[model samples]
Target: MEVLLAVDVRNELRRIGWISLQPNGSVSVGLNDRTFVSPDFKAKNFVWNAYNRVTIQYLISSDPKALKPIKNPHLTFHPPIKFQLRANGQHMLFEGIADLNIMLQQDGRVPWIRFVSKPVSELSKAGPSWNPDRTKILSIRLGNEDCSIGLGVDFVRKDVDVPTEDLLLSEFIDWQDYKLYVHSVAIPAQIATLSWYHQK
Candidate 1:
């Protein structure tokens, strides 16, 4: 599917407290390292654009749905984005903004925006040919300008010891920091399971 990502510059300016564009108002969105035709090559690298704006495009075999709706939408991504799809031909993972829903108040101050991810069970059931390990899905939260809150899920492959990685809307997470901010959350196996257990 062809997707157009339109960002509200006005609101983002207030949140980050600066304009992303250069004095000439040019920004380049990088699509490096993010280009993934083969899943085995997961290169976590990106180039920066001095320009204030940028655009990126990529092709993927699968696209996941939003597991949850975003409540606050005052966030945007830094340019030169590389979108990569994991080796699983069935799953496509990108390193761009996980949450883009933002609202601008009349006063000009940018409020907290909300970002959400789709539940693993929903995505697995929605598309049968594409069986994704939803436990692999992660929700990462950014606070202030430096600190980050990582939320990990217990869903894992019993067979493979795939190292746990950090998920972010930004370009990439540093290898060292991944050890600190990462934490796990429970990913329900299925909606039916929740209903069945609640009844008891």
Candidate 2:
């Protein structure tokens, strides 16, 4: 899955820009002639709204047939693309928005991509408990069992007894990066493992 990043100002289509991913893994984004500077002007406060909205589009495939209509051909990013945003001069890391996922179509032809705007109370409901410093396990009660899984952690807990049958490890590889996800929730205790995984 590839992602393309674009942003538009409130109530104006004329004021729009894109974040381009360079071959060396650096990014170039600009609004008109003003280019975005990292660790300085970070992208932050992303919520879904009509004004000043950021659109994250997914490029399903690179085949010419998949590039249908050819509108704005530059909108796309290879999977595992990671970066940080400065929201209003404050350094807002990408992990701050880990809870959000791109909303995709159900037809299965294309995957979902997310659009973000300013934070609102209603939007918080859909967001995850984001903590860049700590990993969280979202729990649910299934009968008498405590079913919970860790997010933002790189390794499985050492003390927990994860059922071999229930454990799932999956990986997503792209041109620039690779990611791994482990699903093992049948364990009974809270476990702490390594932090996030990033491989070039």
Q: Which candidate number would show the highest lDDT if scored against the true structure?
A: 2
Q: Estimate every model's Cα lDDT from 0 to 1.
A: 0.22, 0.25
The residue-by-residue lDDT of candidate 2 on 53-130, one tens digit each, is: 343522122123322221121212223233343223333323212211121111111212211211111111212224
Off by more than 4 A, model 2:
1-80, 83-90, 94-141, 145-147, 151-164, 168-182, 191-194
Q: Can you write out model 1's per-residue Cα lDDT over 1-200, one digit (the tens) per residue?
A: 11111111222211111112223322212110111133342222244323332333332211224232211111123322222323223343334331111111111111111111233212211111122332122222322222212122111222223344443422211121121112322332321110000000
The TM-score values for the models, in the order shown, are 0.17, 0.21
Alpha-carbon runs more than 4 Å astray in model 1 = 1-83, 89-180, 191-200
lDDT of 2 at 199: 17
lDDT of 1: 0.22
Kindly provide the TM-score of model 1 when superposed on the true structure, using C-alpha atoms. 0.17
Clashes of 2: 13
Cα deviation at 17, candidate 2, in Å, is 30
> Which model scores highest in TM-score?
2
